[model samples]
Target chain A: MEKRYDIVEIKENVLADNDRVAGKIREELRRSNTCFINLMASPGAGKTSLLIKTIEALKDKYSIGVMEADADGDVDAKTISALGVRTLQIHTGGLCHMDADMTFRGLKELGFEDLDLIFLENVGNLVCPAEFDVGAALQVMILSVPEGDDKPLKYPLMFKVSDCMIVNKIDAEAVFDFDYEACVERARALNPEIRPFRLSALKGENVDEWIRYLDGFIREWRK
Target chain B: MHEMGIVLHIAKTLNETAEEEKITKIGSVTLQVGEVSGIITDLFVDCWNYFKVRNEILKDSELKLETLPAVTFCGDCEKTYPTVKYGRECPYCGSYETWLLTGNECIIKEIEAETL
Candidate 1:
C-alpha cells in the first residue's frame, strides 16, 4: 500500500507580514509629521540613561513621547515618565524583541498626535531587535565600552544595519581597554554610512554633540 | 533568544493554516532559513521542541530547517556572489556597489500535514 501526504507550498516570509505592518506605521508617522527612532543595545548599555539625557536636552524644544519595551517590568518607563514626557510601558511578555505589529500597538497606546518625536527603547538584545524594523525612521544602537570592540565582528548584522552607532561610556575609557579607533573602523567597514558618536551617557561627556546631531536630525526629519 | 517568539509565531501560523485546510495532524514543517537571517538553527529547533509540547497541533510535528545561502548583487558589475564570503564587495569586479539579493529571509516554504 502507498501512503499519501499533501505538501502545502506556503512560500511566505515570516517577517514579510511584520515588514508590511512596519511600512504602514512608517507612512502613518510620516503623515503625522513625527520622527520615530528605535534605540537598540544589549542590556545595561545605558539606553535609558541616554534617553533621559536626550529628553532633558530636547524636551523644551519638541514635544516628546517615549515607548519603553521590556520583557517584563516598567522600570525604564517609570524613569522616562519622571522626565515629564508621555511614556508608555509595553511588557513584551517574555518576548526578546518587539516586532512591527507590537510597535504599532504601542504607538496606538502612546498616541503620537500632538507629539513631534517618539523614541522606542527596544528590548535590550543586540541581535533580535535589529532584525525587526519597528517603523523607525532611524535605527540606532549603543555599545558600551565594557562590551568590547570585537562586537562589530561578532554581531555584524546589528552594526551593518544601524544608521547610527553610539559608543556609550566614553568616560570609562580610562578604566577599560576599549579600542575606540578600531571599533569605529570595524563599524565603518561594515557600514560606511554609519555615523558613530563616542559619548558617556552617565558622566555627560560629549553628550552635547549627540544632542546637537539629534537636534539637526529632528529638524530635518520634520521638514 | 527571540527564537522562542519566532517559534510561537510559526506554531500559530501552522495551526491556522491547518484549520483552514482541514488538517488534523501536522507531520513536519520545512522551514527555509537564510544564512544571514540571524536565526541560530540549533536554538530555533530547541525552541520549536519546547513549544510543540504545549501546542496540540504541533505536539508531534517535526521541524526541519533548510539553510539558504546568502547572495549579494553588485550594481556596478551586475554580478551576484556569495554574501558570506565577499560581503558588500563584489568578488568578481572588486566593486563596493553591491546589495544583498537573498539570504536575509525567515520563510516557511512548505508544510506537510494529514487531512481530517
Candidate 2:
C-alpha cells in the first residue's frame, strides 16, 4: 500500500538553490565594495556599444571590468579589451544564458574584487537570462528601436528583472515604427521603479547622461 | 537550447543518487517548470529525448513536467494571485508593492528509481 500522502505545505522555490549561491556571491561583492551590473538584451541590441561608451566615459575615474557571456560572439569582448580595461570573455559554449556558478568562475578568473564596476554582459537573449541571477547589484537590459515596442509586452520578465532599461538606437527611431510611449507605459506597468534611459550607443547620443547616472549610482552604492 | 544543459545537470544528479543507492532502473523524473521560468517546454522535451537515446538508465524513463503558475503576494492586499497573467501588481488592489511567492522555478523535484 502507498504511504498516506500527508499534504505538507512545502514552500520552496526552484531557483532557491541558485539564489542561495547567488547570495553568497553577492556578499563576496559587497565585502569587497564591488558593484556589478548584468547587461542583457536580444542579439544586436548594442549592449557592447553601450559598454564601450560607458567605459570610455568613466575609464579615468573608475576601474571598469567586463565579463562578456556570449554563446558565439567574441567581437564585443575584443572591442572592450581594446579600450584598455580589464575584460574577460565567458563563452557559454552552447548554453543560452549565464548562471551564478558560471559568473562565480569568471569572478575568480578576473580576480573581481579589484573592479569598481563589473559589467556582466549576459548572452544577447531576451528570455533565458531573466531566469538566472548572476549576483549582480543591478540588472540593465536594452531594447533597440528596431525590435519594436511589442517586446515589452512579449518579454515582460526581462523588464521585470531589470533595474534599468536602456531604449537604445534613438538615432534610428525615425526609420522604425516603434512606439516609445507604449513601451515605457508597459514597462512601467510591469515595474514602476525601473529607471529608463533613451540613447544611441553607436552615435554616442545621450550616453553621457547614462554615464552620469551610473557614476552617481555607483557613488550611492559605495556609500 | 539551454534545456539541454538543464537535462545534463539532472542526468548527472540522478546518476550520483543512483550510484549511492545502487539502483539499476528508473521510473519517472518530475520537474517543476515555472510559467515565467524562461525555459521552453518543447525544447526541454526534445533535449530529454536526445539525452535518453545515449543513456541506458533513462532510456525508458518518463519525463513529467509540472507547470507552476507564477504567483505573488501583495503587501497591501495580503493575497496571492497569478503573476504570469498580471505581474508585480495585485489584481484586486493594484498595488506594486508585492513579493514573488512562486514561479521562476527550474528544478528536479522528485526522482523515482528501482533496485535490481
Candidate 3:
C-alpha cells in the first residue's frame, strides 16, 4: 500500500481580504462625512504629540475621535482621552500593526455616528503599518529629526505609500545633524506628490501649517 | 515583528481549513509572498517553526514560501514595470500616474494534508 497525500489548492490573498474590508470602511466613512487619517511612524516619533496638537486645534470645530493602537498599554489613549473626546485603545497583544478589520472593530467600539474626524494612531512601526490601509482617507508618516535623513531611502515603501510626511522635532535641528532638504528630496524621488511638512510638535513650531492643510482636506472631503 | 502575527493568522486559517476538510495532519503549506508585501520570508518561516510545535495539526508541517515580483502599472503610458526599481513614477514616460499591479500580497497558494 502506498501513502497518498491530497494537495489543496486554496488561492486566497490575505491582504486583499483586508483591502476589501478597508474599502468598505472607506465607503462607510464617506457616507458619514468623516475623515480618517492613519498615522504611522517609528517609536518615539512624536505621533502622540502631533495628535494632541491636532486635537487641540481641531476638536472645537469638528467632532474628533482617536484610536490609539499599541502592542500593549493605554498611555497614549489616556493622553488623548484627557482632552474629552472619544478615544479607544486597541492592544494588538503583540502585533506590530493594525489591519483594516481591527480598525473597523475599533471604529465600531468608538461609534462613528457623530464624529467628523478620526485619527488612527497606528502602532509605532514604520514598515508594518504602511502595509495595511486601515481605511484611512490619508496615510501620514512622521519622521523625527533624531531618526536621521537617510530613512526615506531605507524605508522606501513607507515613504512611497504616505500621502504626507511630517518631519517632526524641527526644534532639535540645531542639535542633530539632519539634512532636511536631502530627506525631502529622497521622499520626493520615491513619491512625487508627497507633501512634506517640517514641524516640531513639542515646540508648536509650524503646526499651524499642518492644521491648515488638514482643515482644507477635511473641508474638501466633506464637500 | 508583524510576521509573528501573520504566522499566527496563517496557522489559524490552516487549522480551520484542515478541520473543515477533515484533515488530521498538515504536511506542508505553500505561501506566495510578494516582494513588497512587507513580510520577511525568513522571519515568517522562523515564526512558523516556533508556532508549529504548539499546534498538533501543524507540529510536523513544513513551510514553503515563493517570492512574487512586484510590478507597477503606469496608467499614462500603459506600461508595466518592476515596482522595486521604478517605484511610483513610470520609468518609461516619467508620469506619476502609476499603481501597483502585483507584489504586496501574502497569499496561501497550496496546502498539503494527510487524512487519518
Candidate 4:
C-alpha cells in the first residue's frame, strides 16, 4: 500500500507557547503599571515569611496584591488578608508548577489595576516552578540558611532562571553553618547577572535592603 | 508529576498544531530533550502513554525521543566540555566561571502527520 505522510518541521521549544502567553501577560502588566513578582522556594524555605516581611515593609509605599499558589490551601491567603492586603489563593490541584495560563487566571482574579505590585508566591517547589515562565516581571527564589549553601549547585536551573536570589534565614546562619560567601559564589558562577540579597524574614534583619531594592525595581519597571 | 505537567503542555501544543495544519491523525511526535533538561525520559514516556489515550488526535500517535547532549563553556580556558560529566566547574580550567552552552532544551523538532 502506497501512502503519503507529511513531515511537519516544527523546530519549536516546548515552552514557546507558554513564553508567548507570558510575554502577553508581561506587556499587559506593564501597561497597567503593575510589577508582577514570581516568588519561588522549597517547602519550609521561608517564602511566605519573606513575603510577609517584604509586604509589611512596602505596603504603605505601594498598593500591593498577592496571589498565593499553594497545592490546596488558603492558610497563607488568610494570613496575608490579616495584613489588610488583597490576596487570592490558587489551588494547583496537585500540579507541581504554575504555567502561564494558571498565572493569567490568578492575575485576572486578583485584578492588576490600581495596584503597583502583585506577588505570585508560586507553588513551593524549586525544580518545577523554575521551569515554567509565569509572566513575572521579576523572578525571585529563596534559599534558606537551614537548607544549606550548596543548593545552588544542586538546583542550578532554579538559580539561573531567578533574577534575584534571597538567602533567607540569615539569622539561623550561625546555627546552620550556611556560608553566605560560598553560596553567593556558587550562584554567581551560574548566573553572574543575578542580584543576591541576605535577609532574615523572621527577625526582620536586612529586610530593609531587600525592600529598598524591590521598591526601586518596581518603580524602574514601570518606567 | 513534572513529567505529567510536561505531557499536558505537549498535548496543548499538539492540538494547536493539529488545528493550524489541519492534521487528521498524528503519526508520531519527535522531541529533542537535553541531558540537563531534567526530564526523566522513562517517566515522560509513561506520562505520554497515559495521557495520549485520552486525547482523540494523539491516541494512535507514538513519541520519538532524541537526546541533546549538554555542553558547557569555560570562561577562563575558553574550552567546552560535557556538562553531565564535569558539571558547573570546568574540568579543563578548574574555573568556577562557566556557563552552559546547550543541553537544557525541550523542543519539538518535527511531527509525522496525515491530513484529510
Candidate 5:
C-alpha cells in the first residue's frame, strides 16, 4: 500500500526567495540613503550612453557608483570609469540576467555606504531582466527608436515591470519609422503609471529632464 | 536558460522551506503555472529533472505542474475572456483596452514531503 505524503502548503511565488534577498538589499540601501536603479534594455539600446549622461549630469551633486551586470565584458565599466565614477563590472558567467543574490554580492563589492546613487546596468536583454527583481527602488528601461514602437506589445512584461521608460535614439527617428507617441501609448496601456522620456542619449537631447526627475525621485526616496 | 533560472530559484526556496519545515525528503512539488506566465512547461520540467540530481532532498521527486488558465478582462465591456483565444483585444466589444486578469504567474502551490 502506497502511503500518502503530508502536503505542506507552500503557496509562494517562485521569485519570493529572490524577492526576499532583494528586499534585504533594498533595506540596506535605504539605511545608506542610496538610490538603486536597475537599468535594463535590449543590447545596443544606449543604456551605457544614458548612464554616462545621467552620471555627468548628477556627478557634481551626488556620489555615484555603477555595478555593470553584463554576461561578459569590462568595456562598459571602463567607459563609465573614464568619467571617474566608481564603476564595477559584474560578469554574469553567461547568465541572461542578474538575480537578487548576485545583486547583493555586487553591492557589497561596490560598497553602497559611501554612494548616494548606484545604477545596476542590468544585462542587455528585454525578457530575462524583467523576470527578476534586483531590489532597486526604481526600475528604468530603455527602448531605442531603431528597435521599433511595437516592442511594448511584444515585450509587455518588460514595460509592465519598468517604472520609467526612456525612448532613446530619437535623433535617428527621422530615418527610422518609429512613432514615439504610439510606443508610449502601448507601454502606458500595459503600465498606466510608467513615466516615458523621449530623448537621444547620443545627442544629449532631453536627458536633463530625465535627470531632474531622477534627482527629485532620489530626494523623495531618501526622505 | 530562463527555465533553468526559475528552477534554481525553486530549488533555493524549497531548500529554505525544507529547513523551516524540517522536511527530510520532498516526495513531490505542485506548481501553479499560468498560461501566459512565459514559462515553457517542457523546458521547466527538463530543467527540474536536471537539477534534482544535485539536490539530495529532491531526489526522485515528482514535479506536478497545474496550468492556470489565462484570462483577460476587457476595460470596455468589463467581461473576462480566455486570453489565449481572444488575446489583448476583446472579441465581443472589439476594444483594445483589455488587460490580463489572470495568468503570468508561477507559484508553488504545495509540496508533499517526509517530515522528521
Candidate 6:
C-alpha cells in the first residue's frame, strides 16, 4: 500500500490576480487617455497637500480628478472637491491598502471618462501600499523631513517600489533637524532611477517645478 | 491588522482549488512566507484560525507557514548572500549595488485535501 499525503501542490502566484486586474485597469485608463498616479506615504507626509497644490497649479491646463482611499472619513475628498475638481472618497472598510479593484470602483464612482489625470491617494501607510498595485502609471511617494532620515532603510520596499520620491516640508527643514541630502542619497542607493523632488507645498517653494514636470508627463501621455 | 484581508484571500483561493480538485474537505495549507514581505506570521495565523471557523468548508483546515530567508545578489561582486544578516552593502565587495533575489513572497505552496 502506498502512503498518500493530502498535500496538493498548487503553485499559483499570489499577486497574479491583482496584476491581471491592474492590467485591465491600465488598459482602460490608456484607452481613455487618463494618466493615473498612485500616491503613497505615511500619515501627514503631505500627499494631500501636494495633490491640492498640483491641482491648483494645473487646473487651467488639465482636467484633473482625485480619489482618496482610506479606512474612514471623507475629509480629504471634501478638501479636493472644494477646489472645483471632481473627487471621490473610498472607504476600504479597515483595509490597510488600496488594491486595483478598489481603485477601479473609485474611478467608476468618480465617473472617470476622458479625464487628463487621476490621482489615487492611497491610505497613509508605507508597507501595505507598497505591496498592492492600484493600476497606476506612476507610483509617487512623499517623505516629509520630519519622518527621519532612517526611514528609507527601515521601509525599503516603499522607496524601492516608488517611481518618484517627493521630499516635502522643505520650509521646515531647519526646524525639524532633517537631513534632506542624506535622505535622497539613501533613497537613490535603493533605487537609482527614482525621480526625487524637494518642495514645500505649504509655502509653495519649488512646487511649480514638480507641477511642470508632472504637466510635461501628462502632455506627453496625451500625445 | 491587514492580515484579515490576506486570510480572506487565502480562503477564497483555497475554496476555488478545492472545488477544482473535487475535494470535499481541506486538511491543511502550507505557505512559504518571505522574511522581507512585511507580513506578520502570528497575526495571519490568528486571523486564519478565527476566519476559517466561519466557513463550513475550511472550518477544520490547518495553516502551516514556513519562513524563507532573504537572499540578495551584488552586481559588483557577483556574489549572493543573506540580505538580513548583511545590509544592502555586499559583504565581499562592500558595494551597495545589490538586488534582492528572494525573501519577498507570500505564497500558498501546498494545500492538502481529501476526496470522498
On DockQ, the leading prediction is 5
TM-score of the second chain, cand. 4: 0.98
Candidate 1 chain A — worst ten consecutive residues by lDDT sum? Answer: A1-10
Model 5 C-alpha lDDT per residue in residues A1-223, reported as the tens digit of each score:
8756899999999999899999999889989999999999999999999999999999999999999999897999999999999989999998889999999999999989999999999999999999998999999999999999999999999999999999999999999999889998899888999999999999998988999999999989988
Report the Cα lDDT for residue A58, model 6: 88
- What DockQ does each prediction reach against the true complex? 0.62, 0.23, 0.57, 0.78, 0.79, 0.55
Residue-by-residue lDDT tens digits, candidate 1, A1-223: 7435689887888776678889999999999999999999999999999999999999999999999999999889888999999999999998989999899999999998788999999999988887777999989999999999989988988998899999999888888999999999999888999999999999999999999999999999999
Put down candidate 6 lDDT per residue, B1-116, tens digits, no spaces.
Answer: 66776777777778878788887777788888899777888888888888888987788787888898999999998999999899689999899888889998888898878775
Off by over 4 Å in 3: A1-3, B12-25, B34-37, B53-60, B68-105, B114-116
Residues B1-116, model 2: lDDT tens digits: 56776676667667766677766766777788888777889988999999986887778788889998888999997999888788777898988888787787777777667765
How much is the lDDT of residue B36 in candidate 6? 75
* DockQ of model 3, rounded to 2 decimals: 0.57
Model 6, residue pairs in steric clash: none
Candidate 3 chain A least-lDDT 10 residues? A10-19
Worst 10 residues of 6 chain A by lDDT: A2-11
> Mind giving the per-residue lDDT tens digits that candidate 4 earns over A1-223?
8556799989989989889989989988989999899999999999899999889888998999999998897999999989989999999999999999899988899989889999999888989998899999899999999999999988888998999999988888778888999999989877899999999899999999999999999889888
Cα lDDT of all candidates, in order?
0.90, 0.84, 0.91, 0.91, 0.94, 0.87
Winner on TM-score (3 vs 5): 5
lDDT of 6 at B93: 89
Model 5 achieves a DockQ score of 0.79
> Which runs of model 2 end up more than 4 angstroms from their true locations?
A1-13, B9-26, B34-38, B52-60, B68-107, B114-116
RMSD of 1: 3.0
Q: Which regions of candidate 4 are displaced past 4 Å?
A: A1-4
Pairs of residues at least 3 apart in sequence or in different chains that clash in candidate 1: none
